[model samples]
Target: MHKRLFIPGPVEVREDILKKMSTPMIGHRSKDASKLQKSISGKMKKLMYTDNEILLSTSSGSGLMEGAIRSCTVKRAAVFSIGAFGDRWYKMAVCNGVQADKISSEPGQPTLPEMVDKTLATGKYDLITITHNETATGVMNPVEEIAEVMKKYPDVVYCLDAVSSLGGTKIEVDKLGVDICITSSQKCLGLPPGLSICSISQKALDAAKKVEFRGLYFDLLELYEYIKKKDYQYPSTPSLSHMFALDYQLDRIFEEGLENRFERHRKMAEYVRQWAKERFALFADERYASNTVTAVKNTRNIDVSELNKKLGEVGYVISNGYGQLKDITFRIAHMADTTLDEIKGLIESIDKIIM
Candidate 1:
């Protein structure tokens, strides 16, 4: 049986969106390809609410996250972590030999604005990365509040990992002063995995120009220059397949309305949280709970693997708690095209099995 995905990413793609991906291949350098790329970028601007230069990479969001940190950090980077994804960002920095310091919050907590302020006050860091939403713990950082703290350090390039939040929520990239806001195709975009996208401010591009050894494939400056010079074309062969689907998906998103899409996600999230609270216990801080996924504390110590097995038989599947939280908690995703009715049905199914 094909189980429905209620996990964080690779969400249930609508049949129409999947069909768009089956579109025949086009020459990456052809005018038709440029037009498709141009159209997607324009629509992405409306979705991201930014006028910054948009870049697409044929990799997951991590590719851009790594590129942003490696190419733009002139002095050092302050990475704030609330969960595994944030930790992964820090790891990317360290492995790349970038000078970075990790400032982490407890598992279920958030990276507070004060934490950002304190880190930036040291004057030793010129770049910062914040995970806007961490899937592991289901905690959404308050980017708006953190943006206020970032204003105090204007020279620092601010990066956001919106991998799991961007399309599902309202992230005003320009208003937030995010130098580089990264997101992937799979998460909230309701598309298959393969493409990574970002809105890059000129400040970040300028910083990238000064940095050396920013490996070619994911180089921010290189990618930006290629897109500008080639007219919306990528430096290497692009994922035209994903781009076609993304373009179509963006149309669907806007047709439904961005606000309506976000509201749908919020309603699904709230329903999941309430269900978790009534049965198990909510793992993340309620105030900062994610609007895409819910991390429920396994107060009753249920065998999550067994639960998933049972749910799979019924054509439903959620996620076990990520990383260290496995078995200790469980996660139910409500992002992408998932509807409130679908969420209610999943919870009702769980109730039948658990109760």
Candidate 2:
């Protein structure tokens, strides 16, 4: 069954974008490749709302996330968790031997601004990792409010995991004071999985220069030097396939207009939230809800597995709870190319099943 993905990520790719991925293989070092790479960076800069240099990785968003922390955390990091993804950032820091501590908000809660302030004011940390939108809990952290606190700590590097929210929201990367805003090709970007992109500020690049083991392949300063000298190309052979698709898809996103695209995502998300509240409940704070997916509490305690089986039969699929919330909550993505009508249709069908 060609079950439509209402689950997060690898969300139904547009056929045209898929076709672009099949484009004839170009030598990674060829002029064509450089042109494509350079062009895509410009487009991505516009999309991310940043003037900083953008780096492309052939790995998932987590890859760049780990790279950001490992490469830039020269002193120490304060990693904050609002959900599973944020916690994973702290894990990434520890595994990389980066000195760090973890702070967290209750599940279904936003990581409060005061918490970030208290932690940063200690002067023991020089880098911070935050997950902007957590698919696991359907919470969007208050990035703007956090940015206000960041202004006080000039030396601290601000890194964000925007793996799932980049294209669906107005992240304002530079404005948000994000030194490295990491995101993936899948998720809100509406492209297939493979490439992870990051907007790297000069601050992060300088920080990477001081770190002893910034690691090859993902070394931020190395990537920057390569592009500066070689005219916008990766130090390693890049994935031309994902780049072609992303390059094309970013145009489609702009065609939708950035604000308009963000609005569509917000509208779809609100629609789902309202629907979920009428029947069950939204898992996170209403004020901090995600604009890409909604995690609805399992108030009815119905057979979620059975519900999925029935949905699969009808060519539709959504996500059950993530991690500890499994079965206690369910998630439905409203990101990428997912439309209002599609959202309405899915909700109507699910309503028939549950109501």
Candidate 3:
């Protein structure tokens, strides 16, 4: 049986979107390819609410995350962690031999705006990275509040990992002063994994020009300049298959209406959170809980693996806690094209098995 995915990423793709992948190949350097890419970039700018230029990579969202840190941090970076994905950013900085310091919040907590303010006040960093929504602990950082703090440090290049949140929520990248906002196809975009997308501000591009050793393959500056020079074509042979699917999927998203899509995700998240509270405690703070995924504390100490096996038999599948949180908590993702009715059906099935 084909099980429905309720995991944080690689969420269920619509049949029509999946079919777009089979679209015939086109020459990556052809004008037709450029037109296709330009279409995607135009639509993406609207979705992200940014006037910043768009860049697409064939790798996961991590590719751009690494690129943004490596390309823009000429002095040093202050990396803030709200969960596992946040820590990953800090690690990327270290591995790249970039000067960086990791400031972390307790699991299930948020990276407070005051924390950002205090860090920037010291004037020790020129770039900062924040995870807008973390799937591991199901926490969504308050970017609007953090944006206010960012305004004080005008020189600091603000980078956000919106890999799991961008399409599911409203993030005004320009208003937030985000120099780079990164997301992937696998999450809330309702497409299969392959391509990652980002919006890069002019400020970020200027900062990248100062860095000397930004690595190849994931060089943000090279990618940005190449697209502009080549008219929306990538330096590398791009994932034409994913591009076809994404271009088509963006149209579908528009047809559904962005506001309607966001509201649907919000309603599904609320329903799941209420169910978790009544049955099992929530792992993250209620105030900062994510609208895409919910991590539920395993107060009942149920065998999570067994529950998943049962769910799989019933043609549905969710996720176990990530890393250390495994068995301590279980996750239910409510993003992508999942409807409120579908979410209710999944919850009812779980209730039948556990209640």
Candidate 4:
């Protein structure tokens, strides 16, 4: 039986979107490739709510996350962690030999605006990275509030990891003063994994020019300049398959209407969160709960593996908690093209099995 995915990523792709991946190969250097990429960029700008230039990479969202930190941090970086993914960003900075400090919040909480204001007040860092939505703990940072705090420090290059939230929620990159906003095809974009995308501000590009040893392949400056020079062609042989699917998927997204899509995700998330509260309890604070996924606390101490096995038998699958919270909490993702009715169905199955 083919189980429906209720996990965070690699979400259920529509049959039509899946077929787009099989599109005929195109020369990566050809003008056709440039046209296709340019078309995607124009649509992406509308989706991201930014006038900044768009960059696409064949690797996962981590590729751009690493690139943004390595290329834009001229002095040092302050990474705010609301959960596992945020910590991973800090680790990427460390592994790249970039000077960085990790400031973490307790799990199930958010990286508050006050935390950002206090950290930036010291003037010790020139770059800051914030995870907009964390799948592990199902916490969504308050980017609007944080954006207000960010305005206090004009020189800081603000990098945001919207990998799991971008398409599911509204993230105004330009209004938030985000120098780089990164996301992947797998999560809320309703596409298969492979390509990662970002909107890079002119400020970020200028910051990258000052860094001397920014790595070659993931170099933001190199990628930016080449795309401008070659008219949207990537320095590396891009993932034409994913590009085809993404280009088609963006059109589908438009047809659905962005506001309608976001509202659908919001309704699904609210339903799941209410169900969790009534039964198992929520792991993250309700005020900061995510619109894409909900982390339910396992108050009943049910065997999560067994529950997943039962769900699989019923043609559905969810996710176990991530990292330290594993088994203590279970996550039900409501992003991508999942409808409120489908979310209710998954909850109904779980209720039948557990109760």
* Model 1: residues with Cα > 4 Å off, grouped in runs: none
If candidate 4 were superposed on the true structure by all CA atoms, what would the RMSD be?
Answer: 0.6
Model 3's number of clashes is 0
Per-residue error (Å), model 3, residue 184: 0.2
* Pairs of colliding residues, candidate 2: none
TM-scores across all candidates? 0.99, 0.98, 0.99, 0.99
Each prediction's Cα lDDT score?
A: 0.93, 0.91, 0.94, 0.94
Model 4 residue 121 lDDT score: 95
Q: Give the TM-score of candidate 4.
A: 0.99
Q: Which scores better on lDDT, 1 or 4?
A: 4
Relative to the true structure, candidate 2 has a C-alpha RMSD (angstroms) of: 0.9
Q: How close is candidate 1 to the true structure, as a TM-score?
A: 0.99
> Worst lDDT window (10 residues) for model 1?
231-240
Runs of candidate 4 with Cα error greater than 4 angstroms are none
- Candidate 4 at residue 20, lDDT? 93
Instruction: Give one clash count per candidate, in the order shown.
Output: 0, 0, 0, 0
User: Tens digit of lDDT per residue, candidate 4, span 265-294?
Assistant: 999999999999999899999999999999
> What lDDT score is found at residue 2 in candidate 3?
92
| Residue 90, candidate 3: C-alpha displacement in angstroms | 0.6
Question: Worst ten-residue run, lDDT, model 3?
Answer: 227-236
- The residue pairs found clashing in candidate 3 are none
